[model samples]
Target: MRIGIADTTFARYDMGAAAIDELKKNASDLKIIRRTVPGVKDLPVASKKLIEEEGCEIVMALGMPGPMEKDKMCAHEASTGLIRAQLMTNTHILEVFVHEDEEEDPKELKKLADNRAREHAQNLIKMMFHPRLMEKEAGKGMREGKEDVGPL
Candidate 1:
């Protein structure tokens, strides 16, 4: 299967690279198409193009929104666009966004980005090849980059 990786230039960390590494480690039969855009707002079009034009069955949209009000707003807008793109194309585009304000330390931020991207890559694998595996984890409070909260 073909998988698309769409990332942003404004991102401080290379989450796409992390996702690619994880994907390669777990799945050997996937063809990955990478598309880099200027910022988070541009990811939707890039993902859509990857799906419709490049024949990707699924896409991973990785972005890092800065620590600011405007950045969060932009992230929301980009998310909306991603949802619209997914509905229009009938394909899955996994949105992996790590807001800069999530962690105060840069090291932690990078770790969070990498872990989240890798985890989402695994999620993509489950979506494509093992949907039942994901279903089995429902309400388990699983998380990436940090400890899982577990079920309540």
Candidate 2:
């Protein structure tokens, strides 16, 4: 399958590269296409192009919104646009975002973003080829610092 990486340029760190690396490591046989947007608000259009024009079955939209009021609003708008694009194209765009204010320390935030990116890469794989895995883990909380709630 063809996958698209629609990442933003406004991120202070290289979350996109991290996500792409995870995807490559997990799904080496899949075709990967990349398009960088100026900011999170630009992800929808880039994702649309990747899906509608480039024939990508799925898109991984990566960005890190800064610790500002406008940053949240911009992320919301981009998410709304992504929903619209998904409905129009009948494809999935997995929006991966890490808010700068979510952590007090820079190192913590970077680690969080990196972990989220890798988790979403696994999520992308589950979405495409293994819905059963998603269903089995639905509504399960993280009990011991682990992301999953164990197998069904």
Candidate 3:
């Protein structure tokens, strides 16, 4: 199966790399198509192209919004576009976003981006190859970058 990874240059961390590493480890046979763009808003078009043109079954949209109000707004708009792309293609585009304002330390933010990407990579793997596994974990507050907060 083909998988797509769409990332941005504006991000402080290389989230796509982390997702690629996780996918390679867990699902090495997949044909991963990676596309890099200028910023978060570009991911929707890039991801759509990966699915419609490149024939990718699913995509991972990785981005890190800067610590600014304008950055957050851009992230929201990007997210809306991603949803629209998913509806248009009838495919899954995992939106993995790590906002810079989430943590005060740059080091922590980088770690969050890496962890979030890796975790979503696992989610993509499960979606493509092991849907039953995902169902089993339903309602479990499983997080990627930090600890998993179990379901209440």
Candidate 4:
């Protein structure tokens, strides 16, 4: 499958790189396409181009929004556009974001971003080929590097 990855250059960490590495390791045959934008707000446009122009089957819109309230707002706005893009293209765009405020420690935040990115890559794999794999995790939070948490 042709997978699209869109990330923000303004992020404090390289979450997109992390996601891409995981995807390559897990599924070497996947044709991975990437776009690096300036910030979270730019991800949707990049995603649209990836889907409409590049012919990617699915897109992963990865970002690490800062702790600022404005950062969260921008993330939400980008997600809305991403959703619309998915509808317009009749494709899936996984909106994966790990906010800086999610963890108190910087190291912890990095770990969270890495975990989230890797998890999203796995999700993409399941969505494309082995959909039954997703059903196994249905209603469960599969937190990477941590034991599976029961459904909330």
Candidate 5:
């Protein structure tokens, strides 16, 4: 399985470019997928450019959670817009994290997170199937025969 991580983890650890180098070394077989930093508010324009320039196979945008009472509505609107724009580029997914606040009930928060994930998936499917965004490149690669592998 390919392992991937969001850029937030890198920023959190203050590892900067060193983290990307480490991931590349340890998980050479895994694809390095780029994701925006949470709470940054602005879309990660520079990060996206770097990911594309570096030839990372996948990218995702991080969407913020709404305030306590308006979590669902805020997430829906923010995520929908982010996903739409990210899809225009090479990003295949958007990662949304549940807010970790002491005031909210854990069970209720989990439920809301699950619902948001499902909604995001549905939106992605709808966008990917649109005529302009069709996965023709993916289909072409599948049509070409795969190379035979010798004994592992």
Candidate 6:
């Protein structure tokens, strides 16, 4: 099984890395695949840079969008940060956590989270696959003896 740890601080990074390394050394059946730096709205760039430099394969972003009155700006920031990280690294997965209010119903929150998960999954898939699709198109054109094909 592949395992990944996500957290916000540099100490967390170091501790997670060490723990993952220890896990790999002690357990041959387990694979410590990635270590991700979780992103907050104000620290997105720094988190992305840490993930890229550490060669993490997945990122989990925590977005506290506040209430309906706040306009949900932090959610947008988290998504933007995830996109930026996807572009910078080999990250294949992005998990977003939504802050819940005390008065919110669990079932409603679950449904909303499910919808958001699907939407984000589609967006991420499109972003990740579009480049590969373009490359495939170029390759097909080249194979068909078309000289106008552009490089990927």
The 10-residue segment of model 6 with minimum total lDDT is 7-16
- C-alpha lDDT (0 to 100) for residue 96 of candidate 6: 46
lDDT of 1 by residue, 1-152 (tens): 99999999999999999999999999989999999999999999999999999999999999999999999999999999999999999999999999999999999999999999999999999999999999999999998777899999
Count of backbone clashes, every candidate in sequence: 0, 0, 0, 0, 0, 0
Q: What is the lDDT of residue 33 in candidate 1?
A: 97
TM-score of each: 0.98, 0.90, 0.97, 0.93, 0.37, 0.41
lDDT by residue (tens digit), candidate 5, 11-86: 2222223334544543435555544454423334533453455554443343334455665565565556556545
Per-residue lDDT of candidate 4, residues 1-152 (tens digit) = 78999999888889889989989888868889999999988998899999999999999999888888899899889889999998989999999888888889888888888888898888888888889988988888656534578788
**lDDT values, one for every candidate:** 0.97, 0.85, 0.94, 0.87, 0.41, 0.44
Clashing pairs in 6: none
lDDT value for model 6: 0.44
Q: Write the per-residue lDDT of candidate 6 for residues 45-138, one digit (tens) a residue.
A: 5446545555544443433344554435655766676676666665553544444551277665554544443344333333443556445554
Candidate 5 Cα misplacement greater than 4 A, ranges? 1-28, 31-40, 43-47, 62-77, 99-152
lDDT: worst 10-residue window of model 3? 105-114
Can you give the lDDT of residue 1 in candidate 5?
24
The 10 consecutive residues of candidate 4 with the worst lDDT sum are 141-150
Candidate 2 TM-score, true structure as reference: 0.90
Error of 1 at 53 (Å): 0.1
The runs of at least 3 residues in candidate 1 whose Cα sits more than 4 Å from the true structure, single-residue gaps closed, are none
- Displacement of the residue 77 alpha carbon in candidate 6, Å: 1.7
Q: On TM-score, who's better, 1 or 4?
A: 1
| Order of candidate numbers by lDDT, starting with the best | 1, 3, 4, 2, 6, 5
Return the TM-score for candidate 1, rounded to 2 decimals.
0.98
* Predicted structure with the largest lDDT when compared to the true one: 1
Q: Alpha carbon lDDT of residue 110, candidate 3?
A: 83
